[model samples]
Target chain A: MLLDKFQSMAGVRAELEAIGIVPFGAVTEKITSATEGVVNGHQVILAGTNNYLGMSFDTRCIASAQAAAETWGTGTTGSRMANGTFAEHIALEQELAQFYGVDQAIVFTTGYAATQGMCATLAGPGDVILLDADSHASIYAGAQLSGAEIIRFKHSDTNDLEKRLRRLGDRTGNTLIVVEGIYSMLGDVAPLKEIAELKRRYGGYLLVDEAHSMGVLGEHGRGAAEAAGVEDDVDFIAGTFSKSLGATGGFCVSRHALLEAIRFSVRSYIFTASATPGVIASVRTALKIITAEPQRRERLWENAQLLYTGLKQLGLAVGPSVSPVVAVTIEDRVEALQSWQKLLEAGVYVNLVVPPASPSEKSMLRCSVSAAHSPEQIDHIIAAFAAVNAARPVGIPVA
Target chain B: MPNYNIYVDYIYTVLRTIKQDVEFTENTDLVTELGLSSLQVMELIEHIEDHFDISISLNILPDINTVGDLARKLQELNG
Candidate 1:
């Protein structure tokens, strides 16, 4: 019975193999640039990776990582609560707090941990968590682990959320409302202004996960809350250094004084080894770069618009807006799989989302634009989609 | 507290709106018999919550099996 799940998984894998493609995990042989890579031996434009600012290959970040590795050795080898709390770890936390203009911040091993830890630790038994149905897996995992009563509101629907809040009534005071700045699958922005208004009328703490939106939205790139001008109303912000920061770590910044106390209670922070000295160094440098460079965000948006418009002009079904994440919806799974493979062959790489992973029954080819993507690269990516569409088997409806 | 039978009848009525073709009864398994996906199950919970003016924690889902079980849980919560 324990192995039955694996058997079911094997059946799924067999079906995928029969189709000659398993889009879930394709190996990248080499990363030639921030926007290009050799994937499965085919040279392709990297349109799926969430390297928004493309700080991964920055000379300053690389130099800092190298210097940190040389000075502090490699890994921290212990959890932050134990022997892992280095001076640099504390400094990075302080820097993140400053970046968000918050009084407290805590760092985690990965973005998943940061979001999950906050979700799990922020509320416990007898408390309630109201989250978007389309929230990331980390949020779900954390909510389930928290021993809290969990409720899912319809995705980005302020009316649905308000109705739930009304139903909560007195219990609304103990509820934690969780939403993402930019949804990962379809790249839709949350209606934070309306949600903040609801929170003001109906009492609840708000936590915005800005993993994808950090350094990609707002004048200073704080996230959707800042862009929406409800920063004061937002209780907490959870984000990742892995996206725009181009390093491997996550953080939670809050103006609440309880955040420092929460640091000791989060199992994810206390149980896992701290980030490597090299990663911390690179992330610190990347944070500075994000604050200094507004051009990167502009370039990223330009590339996003170019890809989104080009795809739309090709008569493809794209997301509602021109977010850095452009998802092409295809109703038929077989056609989606075939199109994904064709795009790869045409020297473009994008994510293939289907089934439960997708928000709905439709499969999507999710493309994420990066600041490092040149206009030519964006055009080529769009061209690959066009070619794939043109070559679709006759009688298959255009997505 | 409301009569337990009233809860059962109301649940069957709600279930029909979601799956009009399915034959329903108190003993019909909500998951296996109706073949409700996770999303559908959540929808069912939301609808029931709205109609009854109650908050149903997803944590209680594991213990609920048949239509009757859900009604019983509703009674317990409201009681």
Candidate 2:
């Protein structure tokens, strides 16, 4: 009886399978290269992963991770506040802080934990959180955990944000406004300049989640805040090592002298074990590569443009902006699945996204580009999409 | 910007921008009739906020069903 709520999920699963869209449990047989993988007996080009810099296969990163695994062993048995605080963990935190030119930084087990813990720890009860309507799920979870008075403003509408802030009157100072550097779904950049200006006028703290922006924006790869020339204006920045850094971890950096105070209050951080030594070591190496080789970022954008313009030329609808994330949208779920399966058959692999996960219930065949992808690989991806679009099932139109 | 008629015309224009094939009327349901996604509906709300200089709560989205409902809300906020 306690598990009866799962029936609704079962009904939804049945409906999706009947429509030929299975949105879960995809297993890749082997990763032969940075850009290609074997899935279901087919060698497919990997375009769905968030490995933006393609450093996952970098020899230096792998070498460092292998060395760390030998040196530090496998897992840390304790959390950061307890026995889990290793020297390398503290060193990585210091390195991230220095990279962002912030006074302090705290690394978490995952990016989701960093965002959720920071938001939950920073503000609570009487405090208000005026967040972008299109914010990621982690941010919303953070606000809920914080017990803050949550209010969502129109996405990217500075004027509306100001109006909501103004309505708070004396409570504005305690407000924490949260926004992302780049939205994960549509790959759109936030108006950090305008939002920063509004925070100035309203006297509220600003939190920018750079999960998808780090190593892809600004001269130093600091993310949208730096790209908008408002890095100094942002109060807190939460980011991840999984995307461009090609490792797995999350961190929050702040210029605030009191940022270390959150370490004691964050339940997620207090309860969870620290990242593995191998991951921390690999991420440190990846950070060095990100700084040393800006060409990877440039090539990433070129590939994005190549795929974006190619899909547009083929008359397929894509996301609003051009970034590493290129989402090809279809009208409904059935069409989305059919196109995705067709792309797989043509030796391409992309993410099949549907409602609840996708904004506005829009179904998307999401492709994430990487510097590791060759020009021919990019062409193959475009050609695969074209083939699927040309042979699309009858009566199902592109939205 | 000057009157309710202008607001109505402006809202109609924004609706058309979301979907070119749709015909706008007071009775047109935003979801079923216009086929606007939740994200597109948010876009519509943003355009409305920009034009009227008002902040509409996201919670009001479910209460609104048709073009006339949106118009009435806009008028209420304007007053």
* Winner by TM-score: 1
- For each candidate, what is the lDDT? 0.91, 0.86
List residue ranges in candidate 1 displaced over 4 A. Answer: A394-399, B1-20
lDDT of 1 at A252: 94
User: Which one is best on lDDT?
Assistant: 1
A1-399 per-residue lDDT for model 2 (tens digits): 999979989998898778655657667899987789986667899999889999899999999999999999898888999998989999998999999998899999999999999888898888888898888889988988888777789778787788888877888899999999988887889999999998888798999999999999898889999999999999999999889999888999999988899777888889999999999999999999999999999999999999888887887878888888898877788788878877887999899888777876678889999999999999999999888777755522556
Kindly report which residue pairs in candidate 1 clash with one another.
Answer: none
Candidate 1 chain B has its poorest 10 consecutive residues by lDDT at B48-57
Fraction of native contacts (fnat) of each candidate: 0.57, 0.24
Which candidate gets the maximum DockQ versus the true structure? 1
When candidate 1 is compared with the true two-chain complex, its DockQ is: 0.60
Question: Each prediction's Cα RMSD?
Answer: 1.8, 5.2
> DockQ values for all predictions?
0.60, 0.19
Docking class of 1: medium
